[model samples]
Target: MIDSHAHLDLADFDHDRAELFNAMALKGINSALIPAISEQRWENQLAIAQQYHCYFALGIHPWYVPEDINASLVSLENMLAKHAANDRLVAVGECGLDKLKPDFDRQQQLLSGQLKIAINMEYPVILHGVKCHQELLSLLNRFPNPKGGVIHGFYGAPELASRYIELGYKLGIGGLLLNPKAKKLRKTITELDIKHFIIETDSPSMTPYNATEKRNTPLILPNVASEIANLQKKTTVFILERLNKNFSQLFELS
Candidate 1:
């Protein structure tokens, strides 16, 4: 299986990152897409990807937008250009709007800039939307990335899922599925095909409701897949096979 979105590059895994990767591999998670949240984390993300045989994306996440958003966008463009030939450098985000965050206007600007970069770079996007579905749809309508992307950590209704799928975006199914209280989300998953979704851990964050550890890890991926399998009334192997195909197709992996 593959983790479509995971912040494994963050400091949260500094103590046992290597050990965790080994554990994840043994758990059948062959790779993860480590997305950048800020300019400062890009090099470390690339380094981790290189060492671990993982893929990564470089873009400024909405939460980490700097005071000079324009300068950051330029740097992101240069970085993408510099590593254009690097097959491991896939996609252009972890970037999108969040309604709960402050400076809604600035967040829109940052997301727009990143979308433009993604479009120009011909890369699929790794989007994050929290209670900003309508806003995200509107912005996506304006930008219209043909390469498509995944809506990371998706927790919405069937209508919303269809809307994103219509736009060529896959719904990210992650730790949210483990929450017993996520009735609507589970129902939505039951109604949708596995092709429209990809698995993610979002490690060190979005801890599953049933998790024993405080911090999440990619090792939880099989459990996450099992949750989806139960929701879709399928076996774990069936879910993983299709989800792995979705992951490979999105990032153009062999």
Candidate 2:
């Protein structure tokens, strides 16, 4: 299984990154998509993907936008161009709106800019919307359909989630579903075709059943896969096979 989203460049995995990769290999997590947070981390993100077996996603995250928008955008475009043809750089993001934090206007502009890039290049996007689905949906409404992507760290309602579905995007189910009290989260997943579902750890953030692994790395993918299997009422093996098939289908990876 591919961990659809993770941050191996983050300091959380610095001490044990190699061990974590070994664990991911043992668990059969064949690949991961490490996304750049800002121009600051894009180089490190590329280096990690080169050293590891994973791929990288490039874009300036909403939170990183500063006062000089034009200059920052110029820099971001330069970064995107540098690795435009790199086979390991799959899709564009860890990018999207986050009204849950501050500077939402900035988020909107950055998200729109990245969406334009995704639309132009036909690259599937990796979103990070939080507490702003309506605004996000509205912002995305302006863009044309066939939105190639998944909304990472997804915890929105089924109705709003359907909007993304209608736009040809997948809803990601991750560590949050592990909580017993996640009745609403499970309800949303149960209501969808499991094929449209993408399982992710958002590692270094959303640790699944093994919360004991405080750093949240790809080693937890088997547990995340198991949790998803239990939620979908299928055996782990069946779920893994189906998950890999669906992932390959969505990302156009074999």
Candidate 3:
């Protein structure tokens, strides 16, 4: 299985990241995509990906839009160009809009620039949206990523999901699936085709329901798959295989 999105680069896992990766590998979670949160995090994210033999993405997240947006975009472009030949840099985000955050205008600007770069670099994007799906959809329409992308941590309605899938994007399903209280999200997942979804843990955040600890990890992925199986009335293996296939197709993995 592949964790389509995870922040294993964060310091939350520093104490035992190596051991954690081993645990994930032992559990058959062979790969994960660690996306950058900001310019400051890009180097560390890249280092972790190299050491752990995983893939990563580079872009300024809406929450971490730099003060000098133009300079950051230039740096992002240069870094993307430098890593263009490397397969480890699989996408161009963990970037998108979040209405909950301030400076909506800057977020849009940063996202616009990243979308342009993703198109030029010919890379799929790993997107994040919080209460800004309509705005995100509008921006995507304006600056579409021809390589396609995933809307990470999707918790929208079935109709909203169809909108993204129709645009050739996949939805990233994570801890939200394990939440028994998320009735609407559960229904949405069930209504959509499994091929349109990819599993994620969003580790160190989006902790799964009834989790022993507050901090989430990739180890919870099987539970997620199991939950999806229950919702779809399919076997866990089938869910895993299908999600892995979806991940491979979206990220251009083999």
Following a full C-alpha superposition, what root-mean-square deviation does model 2 have from the true structure? 1.8
Of the candidates shown, which would achieve the greatest lDDT relative to the real structure? 3
lDDT tens digits, residue span 57-139, model 2? 88878878767767766776677777777777767787888776788888888888888877786678888888888887887
How many collisions per candidate?
Answer: 0, 0, 0
Write the residue-wise lDDT of candidate 1 on 1-254 in tens digits.
88888899888999999899888878888889999899988888899889999899888888886999999999999999999999998899989988888988999999999999899889999999988888999989999989899999998888889999998999998988888898878988999999999999888899988778899888888888998999899998898899989988888776
Candidate 1's error at 229, in angstroms?
1.4
How do these models rank on lDDT, best leading? 3, 1, 2
TM-score of each: 0.97, 0.93, 0.98
> Candidates 1 and 2: which is better by lDDT?
1
Model 2: lowest-lDDT 10 consecutive positions: 206-215
Query: Model 2: runs farther than 4 Å from truth?
Result: 145-147, 208-210
Runs in model 3 with CA error above 4 Å?
Answer: none
lDDT digits (tens) for residues 162-236 of candidate 3? 999888899999998888888878998888889999999888899977888999999999988999999999999
